[model samples]
Structure formats: C-alpha cells, structure tokens
Target: MGKGTPAFGKHNNKLVHVVCRRCGKRSYHQRKKRCASCGFGRTASRRVYAWNKRT
Candidate 1:
C-alpha cells in the first residue's frame, strides 16, 4: 500500500493537509502545483532523470 498521499484526496476530502518542507505553507499536496506562498516546484518523485543516457 502506498503510504504517501491518498487517491481521490483533494476534491473528496479536506482533512489531509501537508506542509511543504521547503516552504512552511499548508496545502493539499494531492496535486502538483507551485507553492502558494513560495514559487518552489514540488514533484511526486524525488529522483532526477537525465534527458539522454550516455556512457
């Protein structure tokens, strides 16, 4: 089971709210969007991928 954000979370429920680690703002992090307080971009995965894989 995914211990992360819940599915169908935002529109259906409003009980869960996560504070941005980067910015201390309360927001429904079920969807991807820039922070309302700060312009920091948040993503689901914390991994970085390269455009081209070259050895």
Candidate 2:
C-alpha cells in the first residue's frame, strides 16, 4: 500500500457499513466522515443495498 492509497478490508477499524441517521440508509464509507445524503454526522454497522441506498 502506498501513501494516499485507499486500503481495503479495514473498515472494521473505522466502522464499516454504517447507516446514516439522517437519511436512514446504510453506506460503505471509510473516510469522508459525513453521510453522502443529508450530510449526517453519525453512522452505524449495517450493510445496505447499493442501488436501493446511497453510498
């Protein structure tokens, strides 16, 4: 892994598949600490459908 490169399989440390409290949708986001939709600030551990939910 090089600098500035995105790492995989490490969402556990950062908490993967978190559902946005604002939009009530799950996301597979590592960084960018903010919900893609509604710009929420909190997240949870939950897998969501890609097409059905926002990333």
Candidate 3:
C-alpha cells in the first residue's frame, strides 16, 4: 500500500446513507439530501412507476 491509499480510505469511509426525514429509512443519501426509497426532498408528489407493483 502507498501513502496515497490512506487518503482514498478516509474519503470512502464516510456515511453514505442516513435516516430520511419522511420515510424514516436509512436509504437517504447523506450528501445529496435525498431518499432513495421514498424519493423524499426531490419531489412533492409520490413516484409510482409501472415496474413497481402495488401492494
């Protein structure tokens, strides 16, 4: 390993997902401030795709 490898490790070690304010899931991106599961903070309407089946 080189000395530069530590820098990469430090940058990649940060949290990628945090708790979402709406969905309350840990699928929210910490840096982007958006939820992956519920699409919170991105849109006002709920997203429904044809690929996703309804329960």
**Model 1 root mean square deviation, Cα atoms:** 11.3
In the predicted model 1, the residue pairs found to clash are none
A best-first ranking of the candidates according to their lDDT comes to 3, 2, 1
Which candidate do you rate higher for TM-score, 2 or 3?
3
For candidate 3, the 10 contiguous residues with the lowest summed lDDT are 1-10
Candidate 3 lDDT, 1-55, residue by residue in tens: 6555656657767789888878888888978877887888777765456688776
lDDT of 1 by residue, 1-55 (tens): 4786675456756534467566676753535554443444655443234643474
Candidate 3 residues lying further than 4 Å off, grouped into runs, are 1-12
Best by lDDT: 3
Please report the TM-score between candidate 3 and the true structure. 0.60
Report the Cα lDDT for candidate 2.
Answer: 0.58
**What lDDT is reached at residue 23 by model 2?**
70
TM-score of 2: 0.34
lDDT of each: 0.52, 0.58, 0.77
